[model samples]
Each structure stands twice: as structure tokens, then as C-alpha cells.
Target chain A: MTDHRPDAGQPVTAVGEVRAGGSPDGGRLDYGGPWRRVSRKYVGVVVAESIVTGVVLAGISLFFALVIGAWFGWWMLGASVLVTVVLLVVAPRRARAIGFQLRDDDLLFRQGIMFFRIVAVPYGRMQLIDINRGPLARVLGLSDLKFVTAAASTGVSIPGLPAAEADKLRDRLVALAESRRSGL
Target chain B: MSEAGGGGAQRPVAPAAVRRAVEQLTDGKWHRLHWASPLLKGGIAFIAILAFVLANLRERLVELVIGQTGGPAGPGGGGRGGGGGGDAGRTFNGDPISAIYETGFTGVAILIVIGVLLLAVALFAVAWRMHSFRIGADAVEVRSGVVFRHNRQARLDRIQGIHITRPLFARLFGAARIELNVAGQDAKVELSYLGSRQVDELRRELLRRASGVQRAEAAAAVVAATTRSSAPLSAAGTSAGVVGAAPAATTSSPAEQSREAGILNRRVQELLGPELDLDAAPPESVVKISPLRLIGSLVVSEFTLVLLLVVAALFFSTFVLHRYFILFLLLPSVLGSLGYYVRRFSKAARYSIAATSDGVRVGFGLLSTSNDTLPPGRIHAIEVTQPILWRPMGWWMIRINRAGHASGRGGSSAPHTLLLPVGRLADVEKVLALLLPGLAGADTQGLVMEGLVARGRAASGFSRAPRRAQWLRPFSWGRTGLARTDDAVLLRTGFFWRRLTVLPLARLQSVRVSQGPVRRMLDIAELHFNTIAGPVRAELGVIDRRAAVAVFTEVSAAAVEALRADGSHRWAS
Candidate 1:
């Protein structure tokens, strides 16, 4: 048999380089293919959510100020503003951190800049592949690909893929899962 | 609805199936348990409710006495018979004591309490009458329920094993509950409230049937073996000669007779209908935990360490903080941990593991003994762990994950999933031999220890995390590694309490490769092998990216090969 050992001593290759070397059509298996970023509009959703929360907190603070006292209200408002600013700064970085890759027999999902997590769901173990479009995602023409596996811990939710691509991915994954599972 | 009405011609077949099922449930010497079985089963709940009611009554009576003694002309006494209807007036007027007795509330409460007791007794009787179990030729059927009848049948072929459980009250009554662990679905057939003798015989009969022994043949074989053993050799020889003289006179062949005699000598089991002596030769004992060792294990556990920490903190507080307040706060937790340790590991005091024909049997418990049979190929994964403190003593704990109802963290306390609570390296080897018999004679012990608690890397054919990965793990990077065999992949990690997870190639559900920014900085990635949801979770963190990729490819390939070889998805049996 031919040796299939990976070159472990080699310098790590950049993800961008790996992606650039892969076929643009995304139809064939590209070993260590480039990571696919979620839709940029997801950052907008985050910003919108932050703004809503900020507004709610400001309203509550205003109510407390009118009904109770000014010191507590002003403190609450200041805290809300601080939180809103922090969220605005972090949202885009988090959105950029989300990425997924489809391999020959499994789907890989990686998320989080800090407390990072990477999950892979084997095609054969895939019990359900669902496409969910929230109101914001629908407005942005994006959907989330949810892969449910036999192992609860291995479930993956890839958010912010274009609607058409999500549908195609779901169909392909369902078909692959069925064909692979049929062997068992 | 349309299908039901449209299939009218098939209606007769449905009823016939039902009739067959009913006959199967009630046929061939159905047995009822002792009359006190229900009382023993539901006694706890009944007593709890009765106690609550009596307490409330006592509190009311105490208040009445205090009020009457304090002042007869008090506000409550004067307004007694004032307003409301006849029942209310009777409740308020007359002597305060008489009024209290005449009140509808107390009367209604008493009546309702009595009524509930009566209903419970009646229902228990009905349930007792309705519940009857019978061992059939091919399956064991249990019929129960009064209104919407329930008839459950577990086919012998599909049964995984028979688990006998004796709760505290059941143990008091010398009764046990038998649960048939079936292969597919969550529907388990249970025959509860059986005498110990009956439980043993029924378990044996069911297991025999599960092994494809026909009931009639087993019964006849039992009879023939008993007679031969009881009779003199001369009589036996004459009977054998008579049988040989007329071959057609006996239904059993000579080969069968010889096999029966051999089985009788080996097993010597007595099958007297639904009751039998369990004194037959038991399965070979692999390990029996000593009480001292068990207590030692518990004392050296993480809980005990925390308890010790709190006690030390209490001592330090006397000098440093100069207040005993912290001790008060920590006392409850210390006591709680003590209680938890006692309750949890107390059942494991008498832990014993034995090897059966097709699987392993574990028996343990102090007050309520539990006997569980783990059939071959049911264990999805295994974990052999060594806490830091346990390493000095060379102690190991073996846990397994099987495909069934998920038992959360509480499952660790259960004896069924715990192959070994605490054992030496030799004991661990014995358990591994029983669990992974195919891997025996190989360097399994070396592989397990090297992958789990080894201080060095690369000595046991393991692929270790890179040196640079120490930034993430700090204390444990050198110890974390993965080892692969033809049948299993072992992943080991952790510094304080080391964990080694073994996932069978056939049971792997998925493989994940993940890298964070920090891991990317070190050129390493984490690999996770996901099996069915259970205790044994396998994840190799912070390995070289290339090695992760190789593992991902190799494990996926092995999984596919295993699928091709077996082509069966059921993980348990």
C-alpha cells in the first residue's frame, strides 16, 4: 500500500492560500480547502440587535428616572451605553470568526475568537439537515444550515449562507447522508 | 381513519393477532406475586402523604388548644357561630372544641384522606390482579393495566440481557424487579414484584430462550437430567439400554442426551416451573472489590479533597480572619459532600464483576442489590481513568457508554455502567479483556496506561501534541496524546484527573478537526471523535494540524471499513 502520512513537520499553510488553490466552483473535494466566511450582512444583524437592547435599557432607565430617582437612572444609562459600544466593536470580529468547510465525508464548523470550538458532523451520521431563515436572514437573503448528528455534541449550525447555496448544501448533504447510511 | 375503514377485510387478522398476544401473555402457568407486593411498592408514597396529612391535623389541633386555653372570650371564640350557611355556622358555633369537630373542612379533609386510601388500596388490588407474567416459548409477556389494557412482549432474540433490581422495600420482601433490556426503541418489558427464587429461575429461562433454547426442550432436558442424577447408575444404564433398544421410543436423540448430561454436570440448574434454586455454579468471578479498598477510594476522591480543603480553611480562619463565620458557611457543604460520598459509593461496597458466556455480569449494592448483564458488543465506548491521587496506588476506574437512554452524570453512581469502581492494574486488564476480548494478548495494558497516565510521549506509539502547544495546556501538554489500534482509538488528556477514552472504530459517529486563532499560532488543531451521547467523550486537543488531518482521514476510512464489514448500525447488540 502507498504511504499516506501527512507532512507533519512542514510549516503551516495559510487558510487563504488553501482556499485560493481550490476550484472556484466548490463542486469537487479540495483537501484542506479554504474556509468559507458567513455573509457580511450578519454583522448588520448584530448591530441591529445591539441597538435594540441599548434602546430598551435606555427606556427602562428613563422610566426609573421619572418614577424613582436620577442617580440610579443615570448609572444604568451609562452602563447600557458602555455595553452598546462594546457590542458594536465585538460584533464584526465575531461575525468574521465564523467559518465552515465541507470535506469528502464530513462537514467542519469553526466559531468563536475566544473559547473557540470546531465541530465536524460525518455525512453518514447526519440524521437531519435543515435550512432555517430568520426574519433578519430572510431580509438579507441568507439562511442557516443546521446539521443534526446522532451525537448531540456534534450538531452544527452554519449561519449566514446565501439562501440558494444553503438549499444546495442541504440537498447534497441529505443525499450524501442517505447514501452513506445505506451501507450500514 | 380512511386506512382503518378501508382495511376492513384485514380486521379479522388484527383480532387474531390480539388473541394470540393475549394467549401468549396468559398462557403456560402465569404467576401472581405476593399480596404485599403492591403495599411494598407504593408504601413510601402512601406513607409520605399520610404523614403530611397527620402533620397538618396536628398543627390545627395545637392551634385550637392554644386558643381555647389562652382566652375563651377571644375574638375567634365570639365570632364562632356568627355568619355564613349551616355548615359554616356549625363550624363557628357551640363549644370551640365541638365546633372544631363539627367543621366541614376537617370532616371533608378526613373523608377525602380516607377515600384516597381506599381508592389506592382498591387500585393496588386491581393492579395486582391485572398484572401477571408468563414465560412463553419464544418471548416473555407481561400483561397489566385495568382500563386500557397493556400487553408487552419481548422476543427472546431481541433481548440484550435481564437486569434484576431490588429496591429497599423490595429487598425487605425478598422480591426483585426484572427489566429486559431490549435492543431497539425505548420500550423495555418489566416484570416486577417477583420472589427472589422466581426472579432467578425466570432470568435463567429468559436468558436460555434468548440463546435460542426452546422452552419444551429445556424443560424436558431439565427433567431428564434430574432423573438421571437422582437414579442409580444401574437404573441409568438400564434406561440408556432401553432407549438404545428402541430408538423410536424416545424423542431425544442420543447426542442430545449426552449433551444434556454434560450441561447438567456443568450448570446443575433446577427449573421447577417459575421457581428454582440459584445455587447452580455461578459465572467465574473476575474481581470482588474489598470494603476497605472501596472506602479508601471514596476517601481519596475529589469530593473528599474538597471537604478537606474546607476543613483546612476553617482551621486557618481561626487565626487569619479571627472569626468562625466561614466555618459555618462551609459546614453544610462539607457535610453534604460527606453524605454524597456515603450514598453514592456505598452501593459499590460489595461490587463484583463476573464473566458470563456472552457478556459480563456486575453485582453491587449495600441495601438494594442490582445485578446487571452487559451483553457482548453493547458497550459503545470505554474509558479507563486515573486521578492524580490514584496514580500512586496504581488504581483505575473503568466506565462504559452504551446506546440506550442517556443517564446524565448521575449514571456514574449506577453500577451498570461502571465496569470497575476501583481496581488495580491487573484488575483493569481483566476488565479490558472482558470488554474488548478481541484485543486480548495484545499490549492493551501498555497502550492504555501510556495513552492515559504516562509521563512521557512517543513510547507507546502515540502521536503527541507539539511542544509549542504547551502554551494552551501548560501542565498537561506533554501527557495528552492519541493511540490507535485496528479496532479502537484512545484519546488521553487532563493533568489533575487524567481521562482516557476508547472509541471502537465501528462505533465512531463523526470526526471533527478544529483550530482556533491561538491553536493556529502554534500550528496545531484539535480532533474530536463523536460517538452516541454518553459518558465517554473522546477529544484530542492541541495536536499538530497535520496529525489532526491524518487522524481525520484515517478514522473516517476505518469507520467506513467497519461499516462495510458489519453493515449494522445498532451499537449495543
Candidate 2:
């Protein structure tokens, strides 16, 4: 209120001078942002999926009416269209809210649009952690982290991390897990 | 530049080489080839797609038909003109117009279309999602995601063997498929589209990595064991640094570090075999059956099936062809041949054998490669098994007792080990070098004789206690108080092959005591060694309850003491 902007007589601070990011002493921090966004890239898959769904339902609706004369088919077709439209509109925002947290000891993730879910994987249990960037994911400057453990038949997956961050996390996680397993 | 100078300059590039090697090893383009079998996979996809298209078309047709027919105009009358108009004017419920609307066929048609369509979409999505894979450091990870994405990651350590093959077309395309037989994991990891050179490099890197880790761990364990055993002599003069989690000893020393690496590699190799018949008659012995003998055995063993097939073919002729009764005989032979081929294929495989300071590594397998590394110190006990067949062949199989065995059962089937199958006395000595280094120079024949003597003692009247236990013996005719053991009962049943079993009290999960009326009356007792091997338990029976109790108590106490010592050592090391 009293001269918010620094004058020549007072000490002036640059915008960049303020500690902006997080724990600037270089300690690990959980940096999260909205992950799911309907970009031009993912739209193709979404549209294809929706159309496939619509067509299949329409066929079933006709067949039942023609043969057994069931009433559920028409409802199913209408529901499919409604669901596809809702998902297409709402999915991006939901995905954006979902993200992961990293700590020295564990990698944690929280996802799901309607029903929230949180999964925490201890470093010691991680058999392997890889950061993969597919052709599309690479172009979009995003990466997915795959956390594999020996406990499950198939390894666990954590998607939608920044590519650079994902790689750093992968290396640190592997080193920590292996070291902990050896009781080091 | 001098060679040394050139090499010095390349030292900085060494890490890059390692990264490149990792990249090369993990670049498994072969998984794409799995889609080639799309006959089954692709057929399902095609069906799903067809259903989708058909459903769409059906819905449109039904909607159009219903819209035209269900109109308020006289049913069929206005739409088709003259004849149809007259039919539409004819009776419809009570009124011609309302009857057509009341039938509900229009609504039913719409329902059927939607139902089929949803199912088709779900099926397609599931199939597409399931066809995913990832390349990893140790093995390939493949998973399918839909409703529940099936995920499986194989350990390169347990890969027992590998097979590199190319179909006619694959060969022309300069790509080969690699099939790995990994143990522990049920499913195999197939890499289908790798180049020949890549396959070679991949195989070598995996092998090298596995062996390197195995050798290192074995060496460290051996050193530790040796130090533990020998340091007792100098315990008073100097602290062995093995007490109370000493800071220096607890932190992994240079030697221990190397040994740990070796063990890891060995573990990777063992994880590679998938077709490993855990139930197969021991892996140490490689049985060779000549092709002629193999065929002869097949014919002789399956004589009944063959005869049935022949009779059916002769009498039924066209009926047999239509019914496929001949397939029964053919199927067995084909399966048997395949099994035989698998075994034979394994025999020809070469595995790098290493003896480290800690343990011994026996790596073998092609399609399902595996490396088993056993640290001598970790072995609680050793048992030599002689199957009825092996008895005639003068072959013995040695198995070790250990903890945390995946085998849920106890005893012979308790997931112990198969050390040797058909080794001579000298081979046994060679193996004992790593298994029981302290006894490397000990007499193998003498030990065998000692085992035979022990068996005899059990089967005969070696030690007779009080007269109360005579009836407890299997067929004891002698009138004695404390009866002799089973070794005395089976003295006359000696054969060429002797089975010597050593049960370490430390690995014993429990000691179970059972007694019948005769046993109670004669004061006889039976003690069972409960281990992790499922179903097949090891039991030692005797005619004297007192003797049994003493042995049981002593073994149990010893095991507990050893375990406590091991725990402390683990903490200290």
C-alpha cells in the first residue's frame, strides 16, 4: 500500500531474484501440474474410439429389434453416445488434475477423474524404473515413467511426467532401490 | 599415438560404450513380430470390426423400416398403395391403427443393435491395448491393457536358455526371433524382429552380465565363509570385525562388493528359463538317448495306444478318418517327441561355468536358459537321491536344503536342489569342492560307505536298547528291549546304489512326532523333517522313542543356534 514498487532510494529486487520454483537448495520436491489435456495428437484416438463404440451399439440395437425384439438395445446405443461425448469434453480437465509425487524413498501417484486413487511404491520394491518417450510423446515434450516390481505379474506404470524430470527420477529411484535392497 | 595413450584417451568414452550397449541390448523390435500370429489375434479383431459395421448398418435399416411402418397411416396401406393399403385397413388390435404400434417390434429392433455394438467396442479396445511391450535392462516387459491390462516382466537372471530362429520369410527379411526359456516366470518372452547381429550382441551381453554378477557374489560369499571359519583361531589375538555389526565390516568391503555383483548376475541367469520342469528328474545329469533308442522307447512305451490306433484304422477305415481316433496315438507320439526334443536341445546347450570365492555357478539352457549358483556356506544340508532307475545305472543326485524355497511342499519335492545326476565318484569329488570345500580332500568312497553303514544300522539290529521296543521294528524277530532302527529292518535289501540324506537341523521347519499303538507299546517313535518341499516330506523313523527324542532335541537346538549365529553375522556383514 505504501509504495509497493521500490524506488531508487530503496533496495530494488528483480522478479527473478525471488526464490520462485521450490526448495532451491536442491532438495527433492514433488512438482505437480494438471496432466491430461486434449491436444490435437490424442484427438484422433478419442474420435476413433467413440465412433467404433457408436457403430457397435447401433448394430446391436437393430439386431435385437429384428430378431428377439429386445428393448435394451436402443437405450444402450443412446447411452454410448452420451458417454463418449461426456468423456470427450471432461477427460482432459480430469487428466490434468492427476499427477505424481516423488520422495527420496518412494514414488507416489494420484489419478482418476471421478474417483481419486493414490498409489505409493517403495523404492526397495522397485525392480526397474524406465522413462519412455514414444514418437508422439516425444514431440509433445512429455514422458511416461514405468515402475516395475517383482511382486506383481506385470509391472506398475506411472504416466505423464515431464521427460527430463522422468529420466532424473528413474535414475535416482533405481540407485536408491538397489542400494536399499543390499542393506547399504 | 601409442596404444596405451590411445587407450587412455578412450577411458572417458567407456561410459558411452556402456550406455550404447544397454541401448542395443534393450532395443527389442522383435515384439512387433508377435502380431504376425494375428490369425488368432487378428481374427478376433476382424470379428469385432465386422460386428461394429454390421451393427451400424442394422440400426439404420431398422430405424428406417420402423419409421415408415409405425406411422399412423393404415398399416401397409398408404406406404405400399393398393394391396398393402387393403391389408393395413384389415384388423390391427381392435383398431387397425393402434395394433401396429402396440406390437413393440420397433423398440426391440433398436435394442438389439445397441447391445452388440458395445460388446464389439469393448473387445476391440481390450485386444488393442493388450498388445503392448517395453524393453528393459534385464528382460522384456509385455502387457495388454483394456479392462485389466495383463503385465509380465521376465528376469534375465532366470533365463535358462534361448533359441534364435527364423522362419523362411523372416530369414529373407534379415530378422530373427529369439525365444527365451525363463524359470520361475510361467510365460516366455519372445523377441521376433531383431537382426542377427543384434541377437548375438543381446545374447552375449545378457550372458556376460549374468555371469559377471554370479561370479562376484560367489567370490564374496566364499571369502566371508572362509574368514568366518578360519578366524575363530585368531579370535582372541585380534577382533575379526564380525562382531556386533562393526562399522567397517558391515559396510560392504571391496571383495564383498565384487561378490555381490557376481551373485546378482547368477540370479539373472537363473531367472531366464520358462520351460524348466521343476518336476523333471534333476537337472544336473544330462541324459542322452540316441534317435533310434528314442523311437524304440516311444514305440515300446506307447504300444497300447499304437495298437488301438492300428485296429481302429483297419476296421473303421472312413469312420476312423472322420472320428479322428487315430489322432490319439499320433498326439502322444508327437508330444513325447517334442518333450524329448526339448530335453535333447537342453543337453547340447553350453553355459559358462564359474567357481567364485563364494559359490559355484552352473548355467545351462538354450530356449530356456538358466544359471543356478549355490554358495556352499548357505547350504544347510546335502542329500543324495538314487531313484529306482538310477540305482541300476549307479548314478546319484545330490540336493541341498535351503530356506525361502518357492516350492511350497517339504522333503524331496521341497525345492532343494539337484547337484549331480550321473556323475562318477570323481565327479562327485569335483562337485564337493564347491559344495563342501573343507571336505574336498575327503574320501568320496569312504563317505558313501559310511552312508551305507548308517542305512544298515537303521535296517538292522545295530544298537539294541531295553526289551520294551522289539515290537516297534518293521520285522524284528529278535527279542530285544530297546529295538534297532529301520536300517536293521532293511539290511537284506541292499542294492548297488545307496541314497545318503543329510538333513541340517538349521533348515528344519519342524520336527513332527507320530506313534501307532505298537510304537507306543514298544516305545518307538518316528520323526519327520518338515521342509518347504510340497508333499514329499523327509522322515526318519526308529524303533526307540528315547533315541528319536534325543536326536530330535539335539538337531532342533543345533539349528536354532546356527540360525541365531547366521542372523548376527548377516547384521555384522
For TM-score, the strongest prediction is: 1
- Residue-level lDDT of model 1, residues A86-123, one tens digit each, is 88889898777777666665666767765455565557
TM-score of 1: 0.66
Q: Taking the candidates in order, what DockQ does each have?
A: 0.19, 0.01
Clashing pairs in 1: B80-B92
lDDT of 2: 0.42
The CAPRI classification for model 2 reads as: incorrect
In model 2 chain B, the worst 10-residue window by lDDT is B1-10
> Which stretches of model 2 miss by more than 4 angstroms?
A1-184, B1-359, B365-368, B374-381, B388-393, B400-417, B436-449, B452-497, B534-536, B567-572
Candidates in order, TM-scores: namely 0.66, 0.36
lDDT (tens digit, per residue) of candidate 1 on B202-304: 5655565554334334455655643543332222232223323332333444323322432232233333332322233354356777888888888887777
Give the C-alpha miss distance for residue B89 in model 1, angstroms. Answer: 28
lDDT of 2 by residue, B281-359 (tens): 1222222223453333233333446556656664575454575655664656655755654454343344333343223
Steric clashes per prediction: 1, 100
